[model samples]
Target: MLGPVRIAITFAMSLMTTLASAQEVGSQKTFPARDSLAALDDPSPDAADCLRGFAWQNAAFDVQLESDDATLRSVRFPSPLDTGNPINDRVTMKWYVAKDKDGNVLHRPAVLVAHESGSGMTVGRLVAKTLSLYGVHAFLIHLPHYGDRRDRSIKPENQDVVTTMRQAVVDVRRGRDAIAVLPDVDTSYIGLQGTSLGGFVAALAGSLDGGFDKVYITLAGGDFHSLLVNGTNEAAKMRQKLADAGYSGDKLKQLVQQVEPLRIAHRLTPEQTWMFTGSEDKVVPFANAMALAKAAKISAEHHVIVPANHYSAILYFPTIIDLIVRESLPADVIPAALKSDS
Candidate 1:
């Protein structure tokens, strides 16, 4: 028969293992139907200042608003990435101004949302609507070579990866600057969110520049090309197919690095960011995401959706996503002014 001490030790070890697995599984799974925001680090003054400038320049002045719904009537300003690329031909951006119940502009926190190319913008639109319902203002942007501008004009070749990354950052900065100048927008309180490629871009933005109080990313990874190369043996083979399609490995790496979120994750503070990933996601696998979180040394919530696949992860966790946006990002700070001039 086992001694009492041995039995107790065995039980403890089993319990610990179970608990660790539970945490991992729980983190991978989505939150309940009632969504909420996760706690984030306090905003630095310098970061807030920078965010304000970004909002003032990008949100307030650059957009041509058509209706109260905040849809784009026309684009008065040019894209920083606009190099006559056919891809940029159909892209558009507009201001999202928050308001109080009385129709006055509410001095609330603002967000600049970056989305994966194309139908992903539709997801951004939903996020904007949800955020607005919660009193937070959000601006949805159409990324390069995606959405309406996805014509032959802005092919992958036309998009200079370095320039694309830099320009996208500038676009966010300008949006933050525009928000800062708006009488109704709270300059000090700012957050950012993105999905897939947008998540990668958001991570780069958060790491390169300070000012964003909170950042919530989904399906983010370390190195873009590396994620492609090492996700699986099958993926590695597929990458070769791309090479066969005429992509040079070195050139691809350079392009992917220009926007690698993991390469820049070290630049962020624990208080400012949180990353999430689906365990079964194949396009951007769970292991690659773990490598990113581990490299950054941040306690990310790695939720696994059990047997769920990549395309299903988004659909399966909308409620959790709503909670993530509400709770993951920092709360907007109240500004001195009570109302916006507009």
Candidate 2:
């Protein structure tokens, strides 16, 4: 017979193991057949028109610079679309400027960093810092309802995902224009980098007129409907919320299809674009990542597959940072340390 303490410990260990196994199964579960996702490709004919309208409206806005700090600056500008929420109509961006050996500002390559959805600005800040270390000016922008733009009254469940995504694309594109007017930034060499949710936004924003010289996306994929339906973690939760709000079958597909990245992915320059995906990512499945890559016409050489999951992709941050520095900036602009890391 086992002692009472031993029995309790054994039970606890078994419970923990069971939960771990369940999580693993959930993450690795097979997604629905690709045939079911085909409808996403044939979105409403108005989808392209909507995207073009947003681009046109964004170009008409006058971007205003609020602060002018050399190391760090804050800029606020009006968003193209009005969300009916005053707090979300405006945008705030943080700029991290890189300096030269003599402490003089260098007019070098610049990149606009887009933050992940519901991830605030943590990942964007990390990417910005890494770019600055590599001798590039970094501008990190907060999407609607993220970071400093968050409004307490606006809950995720009440918002329209399609509208949010469309707004994000517009905001990201406008961010590039904002960077163009900044001091010590090379407008001709401006690039774009976005992670996860931000990556999805970048795909669409960068596709518009090839505004960005180089586009780098990590942990993002195509087929918006498939990703939300078959994905795990955050994607799963979003799917559930949409379902609760009466979005199902054709209804859900139609709404999400409007913002599909494939619609404009062809506009992106394949040679100037790079994508980083996780082989084991369950949140955005590997198939979805490949779909986006294929649509963008990204060559195998430009697509890097890391041995990580959606959340664990952070481990390869250093590698990605090195690659971005090497490919986006001029060879002489890269710092000695970053060159060594490559």
lDDT of 2 at 94: 75
Report the C-alpha lDDT of model 1 over 1-342, residue by residue, as the tens digit: 112233234333433432121111111111111101112222554434333322222222343333423221122234534456645633354445556656666667777777754444655655554455345677776776655555653346444555665567555544454445444566677778776667777776676556577776666667668777766543565466556656657877765554556655665666567776777877778777776776566673433233454456555334433444344334342211211210
How well does candidate 2 match the true structure, expressed as C-alpha RMSD? 14.0
- After the best TM-score superposition of candidate 2, give how far the Cα of residue 20 lies from its true spot, in angstroms: 33
Could you give candidate 2's per-residue lDDT for residues 1-342 as a string of tens digits?
112233234333433432221111111111111110011121445545645544532234445454444456666677777888878878877776778777777788888998776554566777776577457888889898886677888786688888888888877777777677666788778889999999998998887667788999889989989888999988999899999999978998988888888777877799999999999999999999999999889999999999999888876766677677776677775665444433
